[model samples]
Target: MTHLFSKLSLYNSARYPANAARPLLEIHVLQPRQVFTLAAATALAPVAIDLYLPSSVGMARELGVDAGAAGLAVSVFLFGLAAGQLVIGPLSDRVGRRPTILGGLACFILAAGVASQANSLPVLLTARLFQALGACSVLLSSRAMVSDRLDPPSAARLFSMLSLIGGAAPVLAPIIGALLAELGGWRACFFFMAVFGFTVLTAATVLLPESRSAETSAAARSESPVEAYLTLLKNREFQLYLIAGGANGAAFFTYLGNSASVFQDVYGVSPFAFSIMVALNAGALVWANQINRRLLKQHSLLAVLRMSGRNAGLLAAAFALMALSGVTALPLLLGLVFLMVGSVAPVQANTLASVMGIGRARAGSAGALLGAAIFALGALASSIAGYFYDHTARPLTLVTAVFLAITSLALG
Candidate 1:
């Protein structure tokens, strides 16, 4: 497997000489602490989004807005995430990874502080957007830095490990937010995020080393961002992998957009109970991601992806049927949701590694484009789900099914 990755690396280097140069500090093996730090930094976006989820209803009522209108905060934040990656990916390539991450973290801390003080829906929405922008930098930089350090197979394994580590955020954030909301209202969630961002910023500044070499950074800076992206866009493999990744991501985003309403409003679960259900679902996803990492050692990434894709399609269909039939069984509904969401991990991990392999020289731009496409499609899907919510799970189920089916077809 290492030989295979070495051959692939050689092929990539032969194709993109600019990315072929060795960094000053070559990492033959990664320390556990290093992986944890990078994964924690990358987890910022999920934490920022999920940590305040339990407060959505309370926030809506406090600001005198409808639930659907409050949901637009998520959509706008996703849009900002997409837009930020477009700029930050290239900037990181040019300016180096560490500085860009620190700058973005500073912005994230400031935005979260501002969000805590928001007096209206629009103000909160704007603050969320800025917060997402900052988080996007962390996301892109972490992935790019990993790609810089490892071969494709190793990178894929690292991505899975990161997902496993970061998965705790989705499992824990909502529960924490529920407690905070109970004690101090929605604003408390934002305050917590600000403090969290500050901690990550300090840690990153003190511990994270610059991954991009001076020569490589200088070479990346020589090209215009548009040209860099255009170079990656021309690759056929990148396009297919991007589509696969984006479609899978849309399924998860659709779920995120409506799960709170489905559990709280439709199923009549209390806010605290809803958070527990969400945490359980996230725990299932984390378990599946770990399985994917193990499977990679035995099966090819593409093989795992194909199997997961089929499973996702079948689960999506079942979920849609259950929603349409108005199945009121919470256990069955949550089970289907769990399987469908879990199936995305292998697909996302493999497809992202494949996409990064294609444009190894312009990893930052490649990662940015991939992240942007996922979030852009996700924002669109989530907005559509929110708009057609109708206090039922139909919109969520239908959207998830469509995206999952698309991902299956794309992978096939």
Candidate 2:
């Protein structure tokens, strides 16, 4: 596995000699505007997924769907995310990043409009699927673009910083979603998605530079899709990171998909208050990712990942215990949730850098594969949690704990 990554490093060094990297880094690495583009691109899918969460119950009622059926909308969106990455990843490798992203942005804008006008559950879910598809394209391309310009160490730092910057969306999304739902109704959330999509499209068209080099593009074109994925799949260590990342994603998304329900329905918190609690947890993610960036200066990526994974697993177990104990302590529950959420960036950022570094030859495909693993597993976890909801925190906490336990095993 190390040899595979080493060969890629050597491949990069030959084409972009170390001396060239400084200038390239100056331009493509975390520059202020580029940071915004990348952050927004990465955050789009999450924002789309989360922005309407506060309205899930309302949307269900309006559409005449059961709670479980409404919950399946999120799971379906996750599935679309996974599928889109698999399709567009290889396409981006062939077509270049800029155009692929632009095309996807158009799709997102169109889908968001469609979702806004949805008259039924099936219509809403279908529109959400296309929305996920577009969001996944932008996401995989942003990830691949970083790998295109930087090696693993630099990429790790950039990813952490990027997450910190983009972390703003997660913090604000629910609050904004709640406010929009209150003022204009549930459809307003989807309307906002369209407007936001258009804004990003314009920014990306004007500001985002093409990072995929001609040499890399040719190399990508030379391989068939089957060969490319086979190259990635055959690496043992990559498989470990995939499992670790996927498990971490599962735990986080399960908690994400259901926490609003638990906090609001069980505990009787208002939508605005629930959003504030989510914001605090999101702030923990930003803080923790910055800490991860600092720790990487001294520790190996694998080391930081293992430690975070262990801590997250413990915190998740505690979450389950608290739920089972029937303790209604909001502050204590949110504290554990904050800690559990904090672990996400370190584990995911490191794991992503590792896998992308290993398959840097076809970075677009590599990123897509990792994203697919994360979201596919996320969809599975959300489905299981949704199935056992029981109007309590038990389903969410139990799913989170089980997934994090898997994460610890993979990272350990």
Candidate 1 residues lying further than 4 Å off, grouped into runs, are: 1-21, 326-328
The residue-by-residue lDDT of candidate 1 on 105-189, one tens digit each, is 9989999999999999888989999999999998899888888866676678878888998899889998999999999999999
- Residue-level lDDT tens digits of model 2 in 1-412: 2332354455456656566643233332334676688889888987897788777777888999765566777888899999998899888888888888898899999999999999988898899999999999999898888888777766887788789889998888888998999998889999998999898899888878777866567877898877888899999998998898989988888877777667877788877787788878888889998899889878987788878767866876787788688876778777778888888889889888998899887888888888899899999998898888897777887888888888988887
In model 1, what lDDT does residue 205 have?
81
Top candidate (TM-score): 1
Q: Each candidate's lDDT (Cα)?
A: 0.82, 0.83
Q: What's model 1's lDDT at 191? A: 97
Q: At residue 384, what lDDT does model 2 achieve?
A: 92
Model 2 alpha-carbon miss at residue 343, Å = 0.7
